[model samples]
Target: MNEGNTALTWHVDLSDQKLPRLLLRLAIPSVIGLSINALQQALNAIFVGSLGAQAIAAVSMTMPIIILLGAIGEGIGVGTASFISRHLGAGDEAEASRGASTALALAAPAGLIMTVALLAILRWVFIALGASPTILPIAIDYATILLPGSTLMLLTIVSGFIVRAEGSTRFSMWTMLIAFILNAALDPIFIFLLGLGVRGAALATMLSQIAAISFYTGYFIKRTGTVLVSISQVSLRVDLIRQLALIGAPATTTSILAALAGMFLYGATARFGDDFIAAVGIAVRILTIGALPITGFCIGSQAVLGFGWGARDFARVVKVAKLMVSITVSLSVVYSAAVVAFARPLVKLFSDSDNVTEIAVLSCIVFHLFFGFYGIQSFVTTMLQSLGRARLSAVVSFARQGYLFIPAVLLFPGISGFSGVLASQAVAELGAGMIALFVMLRQFAELRQGARDP
Candidate 1:
């Protein structure tokens, strides 16, 4: 590697570092990164929220699916980062570069295929997701802009993770910061001032993503010593595909499950009224704002655990896992409190209807009941993935987003009403958190025992 490449590293050797200090170093930057990205999306909702419930609902209706979009991209990113980080930890620099190359080579085409497929399924999917005719056009506009942009978006995600794997997260942080600022600055002009409404909002967001992808791509050019694998090297290398799919597919699939869960929830809420579905949509965005810290902690754990495992430090893995749990729990409490204290106003910030406000208030409270579990679930799933236990992560993901969530949304709402639907996610989140806690505890015990035995 070139001297410049080595100098760019944060050199986070998890085994040699103290957990609290290391986690803070990683989590603070990651949290900021997560916040900026989340803020970009939130700006869309915030702007639409001012347009009225129909406008908000039009956007909210697509949020779940949009998350699915991100998940596919993120799955690829995670797969690449995990492999690269391990190779780097073992001091195999050439292998690391090759892995990074494979990731980029694989992601672009995969993204193209995903986009084409999304295009074919767009109309039917929206209709199936309980989007009314009025909302269908809006969904198409937003989704279409996202289609061609998927490759860029996916590239940015994978590139960011790769750029930071050796530990200098500044570029990742900077890219997101710029993207969010651009997104924020443009939201008002394109969405409000331009008289474009929802389409404008979607376009503005896509442009911001273009900026992110450009910045990320530039880093690999003559700077990282070698670019993230050559596009020409793209192939169905079984080992490379296997490693990426093993870790990436579950996370990606779980995001799909969340989308499915939303459909189920929306169908159930439809029984109450269109306004109710709109209310839940706003409630979710509000909830996501508080989950940022939870996500940050989980990202840190993945990095910490992955780096620790790379160095073959079983004790360090355990320490990092514990650190994730502790940080996740503490942040969960703080976030939950803030959400509860300002639930009404927070909802109001995105929306302006009295009926929507009332429903948002009740649902927001129900959301808060399970809010404290968010970070715990993230910690469990991410740590397992970091340890290369993809199947465990998959099962845990299924339990939380699919099995538990779908049932609760369906059965509960059938027996009661919209109230039951609101309560369902809480039950699922709480159940997932408990299961994650148990599984992680067992893993920690295993790691500690290995340390003692050796």
Candidate 2:
């Protein structure tokens, strides 16, 4: 079949299917893929853990930069996916293909710029973030190695998102799984056999990204769907770029804010000691793992929502959003309970130090208390983006991670010290989730009323 027909065929289920069933089809594979990817992170931490607390702390210090880069890729991905799905829904295959191509075009130069900027500021950045002399050198070394691989990283991230947009969720899922597995296999060899230490971890991650990029490049070459990632097709269309920026800038800012939030938390914890920083790092990784299912569900659901909105099937959009909320809430409950039950063991998995283990355990349990309601915000942000309500979605997204969380991290600790830090996240989540609930409900109401009108 032609690419346009292929795109339409892929979307048939999205428009005609039941919401719960569709979500299941999308979420199950995505969750599995994301879960494995989370596992790769945890294992990377584990590999670094064998070196020492300082190594762990060093990696922790650099996480904001790492996440910041990821944020850029994810933002672009969200923008690209939104545009592609919406265009595809409107039966505009050529435009959808062009958007995907433009995203890839944008990734290379952005990655190059990020690589240079990060390299120049590595030492200065980490130092400002409160890295001690002991951790500074290691942080620099690890970050220097990782920064050069930014292009591969961006390619992998954007490609995966675009593939998911094409209703090739399975392809996206397996791509991540393959990369996760590849990273896992390489970690030991590079870290131990070659004695690269923290640098090895960076190399393994970079190599894994290259593997993912290769898979995606192959996907485009075969032309299995409407979305084509081709250099020749990448046009400098000001309108498409503007649309993408409108939708993507907020998403990017949200991630950037998250990076800043990490810096804020890391800086705040610095007052206590490296043990605290290391503990927080471990706790954050665990939280990422815990949050993966919801993340995957939101990702999968966003594509579906975008398709519905593009088709002007507002009823389906609202129905799917409602079903997603129900599902996310259920997942949150399960995840929160698991964290509570496994808090000690999970923290223990990372460290044997009494101070580090105790602090990590407390933080994990305390930070996750409001996690059961986090899906409210995730659903709202993704739903807004899908519906092309970028500004509102951006506001909601900002509130969840940066606006609320940043201030909370900075101010809360003064009230209770470390315990304050732990509690701050839950407080932010409570507030953000409430706001998201309000926004989502109001939007649905408006959409419903509009549908009812003649």
TM-score of each prediction: 0.94, 0.96
- The alpha-carbon root-mean-square deviation between model 2 and the true structure, to one decimal in Å, is 2.1
Give the Cα lDDT of each candidate. Answer: 0.76, 0.86
Query: What is the lDDT, from 0 to 100, of the residue 261 in candidate 1?
Result: 81
Cα lDDT tens digits for candidate 2, 175-287? 88999989999999999999999999999999998898888887789786656668777888799899988898888999999899899989989889989999999989988
Candidate 2 clashes between residue pairs 3 or more apart in a chain or in different chains = none
Q: How many residue pairs clash in each candidate?
A: 1, 0
